[model samples]
Target: MVPGFGQNKKAVELYKKAVDALGNRQMPQALDLFHQAVERDTGYTEAYVKLGQVYEFMRQPDQAFQIYQRAIGQQPDNPVTSLAYQSVSAYLLKKGNYQSAIPYIERYQQRFTPNSLQWKKVDRLLQTARFGAQAVQNPLAVRPQPLAATVQAFPSQYFPVLTADEQTLVYTVLKPEGDEDLMVSTQKGETWSPPVSISPQINTVNNEGTPTLSADGRTLVFTACQGRTGYGSCDLYISHKTGDTWSDPKNLGPTINTRSWESQPALSADGRRLYFVSDRNGGVGRRDIWCSELGDDGEWKTPYNLKSINTPFDEASPFIHANGLSLFFASEGHMGMGGYDLFVADSTSSGWSNPQNLGYPINTSDDQAALFVSANGARAYYSQEQSASDGKQRSKLYVFELPEPLRQKVRPVSYLKGMVADARTKKPLNATIELIDLATNKLVTRVQSDPQTGQYTAVLPTGGEYALYVVGPGYLFKSLSFDFTKKHEGEGLTMSVPLEPIKPTEGGAPAKETLNNIFFETGRYDLADKSRTELDRLVKFLEVNPDVKIEVSGHTDNQGGVANNLDLSKKRAQAVVDYLAKAGVAPARIKSAGYGETRPVAPNTSEENRKLNRRIEWKIL
Candidate 1:
């Protein structure tokens, strides 16, 4: 046995007796002997360590922690004082005593080489302590209120997700049978209805949880463990909502799942991009966030690691907002309050920005995950556990208003809800609807209207103008535009698109309709850059129907001189013809016409009427 400095023979005898008692599992006897040995020789580090270990084994961390502290005070100059400091620092850090742990870690750091592994480990612990201490001093003004009782009927519920409209909610519940299942509820006025099993096909005897939905609430991606068809310990499965019934779930296939672990999926508003947690090979950590894009051919491509947001520690519970810019997730690696803390990162033109902690009270020593933010960025929802009066732990959903300062950091979003129908028959048609950013000429989102109901929804993030297109087979595509560059109340818009059929008119001539998205400078024939999105759609239409010939015409509202109007209209019509020719349209199949102020569709008595009269129209020949 090593000598205890100060060398008391009686103390050494007591320490040996205590070790034998501990070996025989006589915890109380060991505790009494250790206390006697430490009292005889206050400089006995071995006696103190044994006594602290007994307390820790009994799950009395406070007592164990105090024992370590006393040992350090009794032998501040002893050779083994570093061990006492290290032990005390670990207990303090675990208890969130950051300020007290810092000095201990600094002292312990001095016991090793400058660049040694032990020193580096202690240095990281010191940094974590300092970061957590600062975070406690500055906390977000957040007051989380429990969700409506009807939605919290289950004893335990978590991982809540809402549709873009906030009318539908879905979450996971832990059943008493030791398995998880999905539950859903719909909003009725200010309160939510009682939740029910999402679908018979979704919940199995095994487990199904951690669900995410598309903005329209039509697509579901969730995790299932120990499934017969699973590619991993847990794999993501997809389902589609057709009318009121959900289709059967299908595995996402090998590109997204492996023989490792995968769960907690977050999908883009259009269901084109998928973010999920996986422990597959080549990950930055034991578990990391991976992303995959859905190709146009309707297949999920191979996933790639999100290195910018992932760290050498575990990360999980990713939630990508409808705006597609702000991403909220939980990470154990980032400087946070103990376990898993929530964070938000923004995707910019220069890639992802450094993640910002969501701040205290919003986060705590306990693990926090699965945070859901509203489309407007004004409200947030999450799950938290609280001790009830009965001394049982219960988890429930919560909601809080995100402060305006943080609101501005996230891009707000609004959704467009509508239906697509044939103009003549008024019958629902399954059509492809796309929202394209006019400024950048990029497709923002694409969705398909339900075949039976003709209903569709698309998310429109604030900033810039967009061109909305609805295209279906054997039908003339509908074109519309919206400008949201300025701030406005984040309310949804409703539109019903009526598509005309591709057929000859009764008079053996093609029908004429105005193209509302085409733009030009005042009195100038040069097309604005925003006009390309519309012109490109026109090019695609002509390319698909190669045998058809069309006439492009421009009209004026009689605001300028009739002679000038006629000349300006002729030049504008020629400009459309030139663009079509450049896009590979047969020049012989196109013609330009100028019908100036003479043929005004609306009376030019008001600005709105004049706006309607100045348009570009197309007629099939």
Candidate 2:
């Protein structure tokens, strides 16, 4: 007979009927029958265990715990009845009910011999219970400071995602109409502006929540349910921002979503991997953190269980840091102070390492999730419920500096934000901005500017040189570089770009712009190999417009003698002209000139200004 089987015929019949209902997924009926079976025969252990199983399946741990307590009260020494000891211990420990759990766990461990199931759980539960008691006794000194009205005013905000600069914030809020929506706000100095929904195309009649942004803030991934396009009760969805508007949300498709539930997506900064929560099959738990990488075809690959990071319980609220190596999540499966303690795991070549509990103050007996660490790794943000002076509980969003011990292994980053506009009219222009790794000559990411605001933002992991290039159709491309080897304090760097319209070949006015991509040696006028990409672009532009003629000019800073500078500048300009000619541009279509330290865009008082004064320009003729 099975552990809970009974001798009473009527009770056994009722238990069998309930099991049938459970098998058919009729939850409410099964729950009622199980309760009836136990009430009809107080000794129906099978009925009680089945009732607990149903409660567990429904994620009602407290109800299951109470039922198990009754089972143990009747026959504490029966291995079947003794299940209450372990079940109650697990349920209590999940909420950091340590003192109450310690007695039950100790009793459970006593019933089994060395190395048995009870013996194995003894260590893990005992450790967590002891720690939970100690943590409750002494809390961490760090307290969370609430966010301003800009992000947390009235509507109630949570699930926050931010750019590396910490200036832009996106979060989920329950609208007055009862639907959940994602809202955004930007900071001005210490204060943040009121939040506004990104676009109606994204927020729909159904709910959308738990939004994550890519490093460049161009791609957004979130969760949606119940509005026609979904593979599960809730499935992950994605949207792309172009100019000032967001495209309609598209389901991430079957590979990422199953008949099982999925939600709370956390996208990687590199835009290659995704982390989220699911009750999908083959997990170590009822709910687990899972990840999928972007495939070669631009679709998400099959999700891989975050093996070491998940346990045989629920794991939620995953946040993958922009540096690409660390992950933070909340779990009830692992040993912790209490319900859903925030934990972090470091990524390795094999997979994620075993999670480490964030410990005491950062985690409390109460549940904590939705953790976000700033790019600099100096500050952290999360939401928690606190009782007001009026004795009612309210959820608040808070930020605080990281304590020293918690800051290890996190590398700071830089946020590069800017605007792209027309050179003459100064109107916002939709443009593509590309970030290139100077050392590797690889394109890191490409982002678009807002059509209404001419704005863009990108997060950069510090310790490298990057070239920022902006391009648009029928406009001269712009390029600039940032050196972030040394860390900068405050928020991050910002810049603005203006693209000059390419002049018509037979125009009334000539269109001229300095070629910022051209590079030459310190003294020699020979072009660097890296200058080929830009030269190739020039060749293509001329090829597309066959009748367009252009003039190339070179200028130098005031460091050298005027005569020598002029001589060197002329050679550099001529070298570019020669490259264009060899690359198939007709010689008749182009001319070269040198204006040594003469036409200055900025004063030569600083090194940056001096660098700006030295350039090569192409003017339409």
Candidate 3:
């Protein structure tokens, strides 16, 4: 008995040593010690957790999940058991097994507080599971059928690039076994002829995989990883086509490339911005999408991280839609259905919002690399290995139509260019404009008119009715609605809006109608239903006038009594003030006030007039 006890104590010490080694990322030593610990005590919970974590880091999720389950079975009430359960649930969710993960996620949520971060994560997981299950049950809820389809696959297969017109096809094809080069094929009549190899200056003995043609087909960017002068194993190179002949390929330079790999370059339609993937330092993850602007000197600006969309995983193969708002890329980090799914995000003034997975069918477990959308935004082109009509199997090109709802939001240009002016004088007025979505009454983006020219341009996402609010220091807040729902094809829009200044009363008192009134609710201290539309208008107004500032004040009717009305009005006013503050409005520009029936717009007599008498107002001052 004494000898057996000594072996057990030694095993416990070895287990502790293994855990410490794992914490320091010493994989080999940790693995050996874990084997010894498990041998001594097969049900050791800590040993299982350490083993699961190590396997997870090694990209063996299946193995990790089994080990985590073993730990869960060993100690059902242990806090670490929940962690193990979550890890396995996350893996299942990633594999589209949301239904199977629901029970585990539900139990985790029931055992923890909803406000805790862990519970919040579980809640999201539950929501996704419920949504996915419903989607499966009602597949019709998901859009059906591609917008269009091609009858035959391309002959010599390679990923194809669509020109701005969406007519010309440029791609790279492997030449024999020794050389790989770019090729171009134009649509002539109903059939496409055999592709012709691009100029000798552009094609080399080295391989080129993906190719991108500029809107005008004047500049071409392609991936040449094994080039002699590459900064890394893979780098993006560009060549310009001047008339018939092509210029020698030039490296994008050190500013865009690092010692780490970078490739798959996509340029905006206007040729002012370049989007590509890089494994450079300071990235949020293994690889991220980055952009470099064309500077005034016509040289590339230093690359800036697209932090809004990137997460701590690989994001690659970016395809900028002809309408610059919609960006399509592949990511392993963002919430996805499977390995490297396709996602699209819009670029707004607030930067890239959370990317949405394209969903099943268009996305699968296999890697979905490059994508090309037609100028009309109706058709999309991708490469896959499905069987074609011919007996011979090939990894050929395929084209499908995008869903109507999604197509409506795909535009060539994202930013709206226009000017705000005084309605009477037609003079430019420095004003604030806000963009609000009519469907959800949410404020989306905001911009300010140039002080010098009173000209303002704001970026607007595709789809929905947007409320435009224009306000100046002493002007009545002007409201207008823009409906981009009819923007069937991607195109740039230009317009000019007029603002009417608020005139002071005969006694020179500030106008009674201030923005504060829009935010105030009823006696309950919560937002009023009538205030919903008005608050949305205010949000849109702020978005349009990004730099404009104002204060919100609340007033009450005399019949409510002085002291009580004073406190009630103050609470109401602060409530409006809080909503705007939470919705990204700067607090310094906003202040709340309570005037207990002192600033009544009308006498408190009938209930109708009394209701109007108690109001809130906003003033630039």
Candidate 4:
């Protein structure tokens, strides 16, 4: 009997050893020991924690969460118990169970330091949870629902794209033992059929992901790594769906791919252009969104960097709304809660504008990728880790309803379309248009209307008031204000502005003259302060033309007295001269002069003309 007891004790000790090994991520050995330990002591808490941890490592968050809850109940006050609770809360939050996660998050916060990093993470989680809960409460919100039983129970699957009519679905799937592959399902009425593996020609030994289907579902674009012929480590490839068969995958060529990785290709609704991500040259950050337009001859134009919009971090996973005005992409460069967040910017006459963060519940500290907004702008679909109906945690696709107010303002292609025309003839004119954020007065984008067509389109970021200024040589500067703060979803607005010709007396047309190019508000002196940006532009231009001498002339409308107007204009011109001199432009190369109402460019017929009368010009003499 003594010998038998000793053998039982040794078995228990071996079981305990196995459980500890499992906790440390010793998978095979832990598996052997867990089997032995459970046989010896069926109720060991440490053994359960270890077992749950292994399952969690295997991407089974539900099992891990359940075991963690059990361990917490067994030892509610332990620090490890709090950790277990945090794990479950994080998993649930990722699963979009904002309400379900609240209790765990609140409990963790109540027991931990609010200022600690851990607490801060919990705070962000709570904020998103609250937002999600509110989203569910609003009747106007278009809550997104998963298509019934259409998704397969694969180890991992994400990045869903639909055909133009929303009748077909294609996505990426990763099996437990196989490489990631593209899979497609057809929509028969309301239900999507089980996904069928794509053609074997496209699924090589390498990895492929983030598939984008064309409107007709005839073209497919995706990312592939370590391919036979690619410009980078991972490059984008396209395959055509031809009558019940897929053609061999073909590389997008050097025009779209570079020495650096390029992936996540999204085609415009018209299929005339391709938007994708790359870390090639001329990017402001690690990865930038670049586009290649398809020419009429059926060839692709060289890829160009999206300079105005991309930052120094990473920008990826672009989704061009059918409306053509909105371009949604993921970025890490812009200010956000954390990691990669979804951002959208409008396309205007200028290029793309500064992007706006999608905010809160739709975006969290964790990585958010591949967003698709419905045509109505009411609902958005994205890939996220979620809890299954069977209570297992896995990376799955989710859809959420955007707030009504947000949806109204996020148009698929609602844009401010207009031509910078000659005010007198209504003839299109090439000019520079600057979109400035009213809140920060920061220049968001600088666009040049077509010299041939005088037409331009710019991207308008969501929210905020913007000041749009159109400037060009020989034309009176035009200013327009856009109040997107109140813009409704799906509403596209158009504004056609006419620019008046600058009168001869306003400084007279001098070849290569630097037009006052200075921007300011009326009745203000001290340079209007914000005049530095244009001044800097002038400084750079002057630096490039060392032999050029410019006269900075300031003029005013008839509203102000001649003396005051003259003095203000002179001071303003002197301010520009002063700035250039300070910026190393030779002081002798610059001169200042002022002409009040005597140089009015427009007839003093109305307030609008009077506003135009007050101006500035630079003459190269």
Candidate 5:
């Protein structure tokens, strides 16, 4: 038996009684007997440690920590006090009291054995302590208020998604038997209607969580588990809302959802890219965020892992704001208050930036995840567990205003919505609408018109000019441009398109059309690699009209001397002629000319018109 003190007979007797009470699981009695033993002998190390053990059992961490502190003071070099440093630092660090835990960890390091395996963990805990101390000193005032009873009722509610107009709310509610279903409510001013189940096509006996909606609110994507045809235990599924009814849900296929686990779909504003959580394999973390972009061919490309924002620990629940630059997610990998702290990361052309913790009050020792922010970055919504009147714990959704410093990076965005119809019949037609950034000639997004209604909408992120192409079978592809340069919040544009039917002699007219597809580098007439796509279209057009001859002309803005502009323009026209001749077009049927700055379609004062002035035109001869 370990002696309680050097030579106190009554203290020894009291230690024996305390040990009996502790063995019987009587924590309060054991605590009092141990306290009495320590009073009889102030240097009683055994009694002090036993008192701490009793306090720890009673869930009194502060008293337990004080017991260890007193033991260390009485016997500075004792092994019992040295080991107690681990528990004291743990309690302080877990509560985010980093400054108080710092000295306790340092004292532990001095007396702890170098070969002990716990030193490595102690080092990590110490670093987290230092980080938390600084982060909490200047915390944001985050006051989250529970949503109204109309939206949150019964078993549980979470994962709220708001539309671009902020008039609709879509979310998920957990039912018994571990199943989840999507629910929706409409906003009438500040009050929301009672939420109703979205659609029977999406609800099933299986589990579904983390529902995300497209910018137009026509497409719905979510997670499903234990799927019959899924490669993994869980998979992502999608549904299309047509006319007031939703189509049957379809799995995203092997390109996106693998055999491990996938959930939490976050669709981009443009509806061309998807950000989700997956833990299949070959990722930096156990459960990391991955992305899959829509291809021009109408198929999803292979998903890629987000390397910069993921770590060895688990990461999940990605919510991309309407600004498209800020990303928020839940992570156990990034060091924070404790279990699953919410983090935010800014995006760039190259990749994502390093993640930053959302700070103290917004994040706590308890699990804080499933966060969603509005497009304007003004408000955010999240879910938390609270005790119900029935004494059962239930999760509910809440909303709060975000600090301005956090919303500084929110990008103002504008969207273009329209429908596709036939010019001759004036009837809706199924078509593919593709958007290209004229500044970079890069494909921005590709959305398909609803087969029945021909209605389509896509986000035009930020204020820039974009080319929208509408293509369908047995019809000529119609190209148009929309300028959002002056667009801001509470602003949007609406326009309808009419496609021309491809008749036998329709394009054989002597009328001239600008070759808007051709692209050239600044101050150089050399064609770019992507310009091949446009030239190929011309090749097909010529093949259809074998007997027709055309004259190719080039024009430029009136910026340089006439002599220099004529030379440059002629070179550009001949480049098209050369390409046609190389592609087996008879040399006698093609002619090249340089119009220079003589044909001014639009004034060159503004940059948009200047871009319109620099172009190639073809006329039937």
Candidate 6:
């Protein structure tokens, strides 16, 4: 039924006059008529709605909001409630009056059929209001400060990223000429050195921005548009850092990039997994986040949309932290205060958890993008517009101490930075490095030492034992173990690795080195489950050199009686031999020995030295 259908003829006539006055652009006359019409018949819904519309036309949203509320209150079951609910909710939400918007949003949700498209839209709005109210009530403890003037040299800078050690910073600079380029800076003691062009090969006359760096800072993946060979409007390009120079850029290829749009790349610490944004078909949103993995053949596989983290709205600027579990991105769909709030989601055993808005004041009514978190979970960097010293607005990088509440949600990480060199020559060697989680027998990360300098850095999330393997052509692969399952302090560990060549010895003795990663339970000869990763590496080594015969020796730290130690060591060596034989290695090509207590690599004094004493060693026979 038409609102006020036979109830108030005089009010209806006044509303008609008010509508005519509004058509004539007589604002004062229309307001006076609307007020008289609503006053003449308090329950006339049409008169009230017309009054509110006139108030809205006059740019008085507060008055219009009050008028709409009165119309709904006076006629709760009137058919006009739908329009009133939508109008009031929109104004309240736009004004960030989320607390006031909630009740109207609930009523708005009721007007549509359940599960209909309209209902889903309203449902999302309700969630946004609820989340916004809660966020306003409890803001994250953060105060973002602008980066050093040296680093923010340009009028516009954004998309900041850092190396695993937090020593190197990279970001996109919107130059005064309007072309974007990647800029880089190195951290001095307390301040950053002035930023310069990242590389001539990576930056071009075209646009090159939204760069992501591998934890080691050796691999860079970024977005480039125009003036380049591309598969889309903008496509991802990759470059490698060897010694101190960056290699020429290459497109990521069509398997990951499409004729549509693909940009904003985020690389895993190892550079094996890539996450980015795309507007291609098969996405849940107009622009969705997608991921691809580097195959064993070193090719990126077909990209799959990150459906769990993406919504029916755009998601951009994904940052896979050094720990590789926490994912930070910008989104317009998720429940938030307003436009493009920053959100974080964690990859769990099952899948990615629901994204949580980073919350106010880390988020606000304005859009937030390109958030970078430190490996230790201590700092976060993002881009925001601020008035410069010249009193003109510019986009600059701001950093803040990550809150303790959020810090607990992510794993703290450290890194191993070092050089891979030849043992005999003490010269740099290009080698592939892998870090494997011993507990799960899964590769934690993989990286490559720079071909020229042999420099490498591997990220290690705390609370796990790891097997580190270094492999290069014509070199005997090296293995080492790190036990970080217990609480440990420090930003990272550093060491130099010297790998021996896989050649016959000069003949003082057979070539030998301790296998630091092999594991055996105390007082037992059975191989623990965690030993499989190391054993598998050994098996592969033997397979590659099928003609070589080898001896596996076990040692003890002299803590036990000589007889018991000898027996234990011998059984352990035999166990390894048995595993190799079972794995298809010829029994005749292997020998087992027990050098218990007699062949200690280090004196059996401190626990650390004693640990070195009890180990498995392999020698070419």
Q: Over the stretch 33-116, how does candidate 1's per-residue lDDT look in tens digits? A: 999998998878878877888887777888988888787777665656666777788777777778888888888888889979
**lDDT score for candidate 6 against the true structure:** 0.87
TM-score of each: 0.91, 0.73, 0.50, 0.46, 0.75, 0.84
Model 6 C-alpha lDDT per residue in residues 282-312, reported as the tens digit of each score? 9999999999999999899998889888998
Model 5, 82-133: lDDT tens per residue?
Answer: 6578788888877777899888887787764674777766666777777778
Candidate order by TM-score, decreasing, is 1, 6, 5, 2, 3, 4
Q: How far is each candidate from the true structure, as Cα RMSD in Å? A: 2.9, 7.3, 18.4, 13.0, 5.7, 4.8
In candidate 3, what are the lDDT values of residues 490-596, reduced to their tens digit? 45456787665555445565433444224333465687554566675566666776766667777778775699888888888888878888887888867888887
| Lowest-sum lDDT 10-residue window in model 4 | 1-10
Q: Which candidate is the best by TM-score?
A: 1
Clashing pairs in model 6, backbone N/Cα/C closer than 3 A: none
Quote model 5's TM-score. Answer: 0.75
Q: Give the Cα lDDT of each candidate.
A: 0.88, 0.81, 0.70, 0.71, 0.79, 0.87
Question: How displaced is residue 261 in candidate 2, in Å?
Answer: 2.1
lDDT of 4 at 182: 84
Which model is ahead, 1 or 2, in terms of lDDT? 1
Q: Lowest summed-lDDT stretch of 10 residues in model 3?
A: 140-149
Per-residue lDDT of 237-313 in model 4, one digit per residue for the tens?
Answer: 88866446788888888888878888898976545678998888777887889989877576789988888778877
Error of 6 at 85 (Å): 7.8
Residue 359 error, candidate 6, Å: 2.1
Please list the residue runs of candidate 4 whose C-alpha ends up more than 4 Å from where it truly belongs after superposition: 1-142, 376-378, 387-393, 412-621
